[model samples]
Target chain A: MLLIDDLHASIGDSEILHGVSLEVPDGEIHAVMGPNGSGKSTLAHVLAGRDPYEVTGGRVIYDGVDLLAMAPEERAAAGVFLAFQQPVEIPGVPTMYFLRTALNAQRRARGEEELGPVEFLALVDTKRRLVDMERALLDRAVNDGFSGGERKRNEILQMLILEPRLAVLDETDSGLDIDALRVVADGVTTLRGPDRSALLITHHQRLLEHLVPDRVHVLAGGRIVRSGGPDLAVELEAHGYATLDSPAVEPRTASAGTASIGTISTGTISTGTISTGTISTGTISTGTISTGTAR
Target chain B: MTAMTRPATARRPPSGTGVGMGVQVPERAREPEWLNAARRQAVAWVDANGFPSTKHEDWRYTKLDSVLALPLAASSGRGAEDGPGSVSSSDLPTPQLGVPRIVVVNGGMVPELSTLGTSLPGGVRVESMAGAVRRPEGRFQQLWTRRLGGYPHALRALNDAEALDAVVIDLPARTVVEDPIEVVFVSMPTGDARWSHPRLIVVAGARASATLVETYLSVAGAPSVTNALTQVELGTEAELVHYVLQGERTDSFHFSSLEGHLAEGSRLSSRLLATGGRIGRHEVDVVLAGEGSQVDLDGLFLTGAGQHHDNPVLVEHAAPGCTSRQLYKGVVTSDGHGVFNGHLVVRPGADGTDAVQVNKNLLLSERAEVDTRPRLEINADDVACSHGAAVGRLDPEALFYLRSRGVPEREARAVLVSGFAHEILERFGSGPIRRHAEELAAAAGLIVLDEDHCSSGAVTAGTVHPGRGGRAQ
Candidate 1:
């Protein structure tokens, strides 16, 4: 359903994503795990068509259409949704009003009949129960003065209403408590179907426990270094991302079983050094990843 | 009576022409001695000062060149060729709030057109200004003599001198009138260019509470001008809510001055909405005379195309422990000009005073202009005072958010502009008035959107006062 081929993007003078290649077939859930500054959020923003991120190279194909060529609203109409890391606060605009406008807009763009107020309200009531959103929150301004957990739940509510073909969750579990995480996870899990696919971007494997993924890819040095089953998330959580940086690492295919671990060379890589370190390593691996043969 | 064919140069009105041309005045010999003397003094004052020009600081942004050159005449009390006799109920600017309405046509009270239910509370007196002036006794005498003291502007003086008939509303001590008293000033200009000076005096005794709505509307298109003045006095612990709605013709001019004095523990809230006229200026002066008195002044002006609107508000915290707040917002589009000048003065020894003033404007077109000035003069050592003014376009982020949701660009811009004006409209305490304000704001938003999308239609074509004939100017 989604194909990202050697997508090289940058913001200003710094290139965040270099020759990153990944793909998620229909009816499957894929998780992209990386440490801080691993281009996890950058990849999500680029896919959502945020203007600040300049896509310098490569193309993204979704449902046999050029995704990069479409505007953000067009992408939304074409069934691509991005649950932002931090939902923007739009003052003076009621949540229900905003949601109704958005839902009708996307529907209209797709040549579908728009929903009337009564019908939209009924649909919103049904979806509100799925995420346990407070009834009062619907009347308040969109995400204005909302707590961290409410914003995430609101995002899920939108996802349920839009019912997009592909969903991208960026750090959805970062600021959530245990209860909120479970609620968000339940919302996402309910949307899983044969025709719908999701790309979950996170640093922790805890979210994976609730919404298990069919494929887990470790995005390091701006490239997918390894691909495996859900077990990769458990491995990364057990021994951090330090072990994934070893030389002569084998690229595990999506259907591969447990692979042998290489000998560890314990070298202290200080915190805050990953951003610059990953850029240098990414430059070296650009030649190979650009061929679209990394996955 | 000659029609104003084109913009006239700056010139003075005919000399010795009693302010407003003395069109509807009764015999001078029949007037009370004190009232006649007062009028003579006011006329003298106006003739001495003449009409204010751009050289004056208060009238700097609002030019009176074309307005002064019009053949200014006062309306005869009888219905003119172009008058409210032709104005239907649907032509009114705001929705009928079912209040006790007093309709004044051509500067005189229309008793047949007005409706004051028999259930009016005791100690409440609503009478014509001419009637009140004839009976020179107690409260009415005191209020008439103290007509907007201290601020001697030219137009106000003119209104005082030529005022043939005015509205006098007096509420005695502890009288609480549940129904609002609405004063509707309908200006209908005949072929000759005319001006009307309507005076309104409201006195709320100690612990008295009332709501007053003053609506200025022109039903005719003749080049007419309205220079209105309203004086309000709130006694100790008294509360009054005043609302002014101006919807004159685009070719005409409207100028209004409202002066309010609040006594100890008194509370006054005033709101002004200007959405009409080629040249509109509203000047509000509020004085917190006693300790613990409070004042709130909120205004919204929406101008488009060749329209120019100005609001100059001056609030004085004269006593200790007094508080005042002012918020004025404007939306100007397509060569429209808006001006907001707010002055907050905390008098000497008026310690413990708290004052805040904010002026924000939105320009929807490249040619739209706004001048916002907030002047804070604090003399007290122990006081909290702050003033801020901002003039800019709509928030691009807010616009993008709405557009990203698939709302058309024009619709998105309209929504954002409505939101900006809603902040001030919502401050109105009355439900019907607030709803009326919302309607005006929506109309203004549509006008802005239409201007943005199409260049052919003129902005002033969408008049707030619908179903009106005769094009002023």
Candidate 2:
């Protein structure tokens, strides 16, 4: 459903996502695993089209259309969701109001009728149980004074309400206790369906245990050095990436209009060197998608 | 404790001095010797010193050049020369101050408008400040000289130096005033550019509770000046809630200083709402004189259409464990200017004091103006004191969200302004008055209610319009 092709991006003076390439077909789960700072969060933000994360090179395509050209809210309306590692605290803005407004924004963008408050409330009540988030969170200001678990759960709640075509979860397990982790995993599992795709970004393979991925890509430096079945996660967690030799992943279907993604060497984690999220390795251009439902 | 333990100096008025030069009497009052004596002395001082000018720290922003341009009216006007009547009854204070209310028209009390039953607890004193000075056994004698200087205003000094008539409210220990005490001062424009100073004194004794609502209102659209001063003392364990609503005629001007003292364990909450007048300024000075006391100073102002409203609040923490919170908000439109200068000072050794001060303003027009300054001078450590201030226009995103939901352009703008001001108005404990203040706030455009958003006719639902740049005024 989403195609990222050799995308190169930067924040301020430092470059993070450098020429990264990836794609998730319809109804599939893609897990991008790398050590800390391997451009996981950056990729999610870049997909969500956050501003000032300047794209020095490459494009992002989603649902058979160019995604990088869209604004953040536009991308949001086009069914692209980014679950933040740390949700922002917007005090005084009630959660229900924010969620409803965001939902309507997306609906209105798609030329669909926006749901009334009554309809929205009913929908939220049913989904609240799926995420195990209390109904009280809906009445409060968004993310204000919420516990770490509550923030993560609230993100999932928004995701469930929006029901985007493509979902990018950025370190959803970072602050969660084991209980919260299970709850988040279950929420993701419930939302998994034929028309949706999820890209779960994580450092640990523990989340993979709950929501197993069809593809496990080890983003040791920046590029996906190794791509294999879910067994690669179990292997890395056991012996660490030290013994996991860097092998060339699948080659491109065809050379794109832009420069090919650069080769990357696996830097030892002990070096304490690279800031880790540099994206020159496997960044992909999103322009490959041609039209709606074209995937 | 000695009287000199604090900064209040006791001068005793040079005993025999008479009403000094340039000071004229407001009107004649049949008075007792001591009352006339204090008036003569005060008048004498004011006459010798005219009123404070731009050079005075407090009078700087105020342009009293009009006072200087006066064919000044007599200091006092009698029965036939009333100002409140000149002000159309429709414009006079509505929602009558429901108590044994006192109406001080101009600087002297009007008996026809004054209603007080002899229902009083024995030993309790409630009289006019001028009458208090005249009466040897009244409540004003003891508290007047003791607390007047605590709120220093040249006009107040002038009132004290020559205060022939003032309002004095005294609640005896353990006394409860079931009904609030209301004081309404309506400036009567009897002559061109006349200036009148009305002074008020309210003292709540130990365990006493009372609500005082002072409306510095007006009677005429003509240019007139009302300069006044109020001193309140809340004794040990006493509670006082004071609300001052100052809305003068567009052509008139107003200047007043309110100084309050809270004794040990006492609580006082005061709210100031400035809605009208060509130029209106209210300065509140609150000093927590003893431990375990709390004072709340709240204010809301709406300035637009060539109006200038200024509310400068000063809160002094003189003892430990004292709490004071201040929130002031306003909106300025069409050449209107709103100024809020809040100073919170924690003197050395005043520990564990929890004080919060915040000021937020919305500028509805490019020409609209706001000057917000919250100054904190904390000399004590281990204190939880915070202050913040901001001034800007309504949030466009919030506006868009509201409009997209079918709230029209006008109503949406009003909701945002009112919501911002609501944060401050919510502090007023009185619901009815708060509602009235909310309505009064509509005039300033500082806050607009939801009902205010709906335009006339086409009752059901309508498309929300978007307003940009300036007030689609």
DockQ of predictions, in order shown: 0.17, 0.05
* lDDT for position B149 in model 1: 39
- The residue pairs that clash in candidate 1, if any, are B221-B470, B221-B471, B221-B472
* Clash count for each candidate, listed in order shown: 3, 43
lDDT of 2 at B271: 86
Alpha-carbon runs more than 4 Å astray in model 1: A12-15, A218-226, A246-295, B1-30, B76-85, B147-149, B446-473
Candidate 2's residue-wise lDDT over A1-295, tens digit each?
8887888877654455657787788888988987654567677777866654788887777888888887666777777787878776554446675576567666766888878767877898888887788887767666779999998998888888888878889899886888889987887888899998899999888898999998887775455677788998898899876565764332322233222222222222222222233323223233121111110
TM-score of each: 0.83, 0.66
Tell me the tens digit of each residue's lDDT in model 2 across B123-178: 66667644465565665656665643332544665666544367778788889886
Docking class of 2: incorrect
Q: What is the lDDT of residue A95 in candidate 1?
A: 77
Q: TM-score of chain A, model 2?
A: 0.82
Comparing only chain B with the true structure, the TM-scores of all models are 0.87, 0.82
User: What C-alpha RMSD separates each model from the true structure?
Assistant: 9.0, 10.5
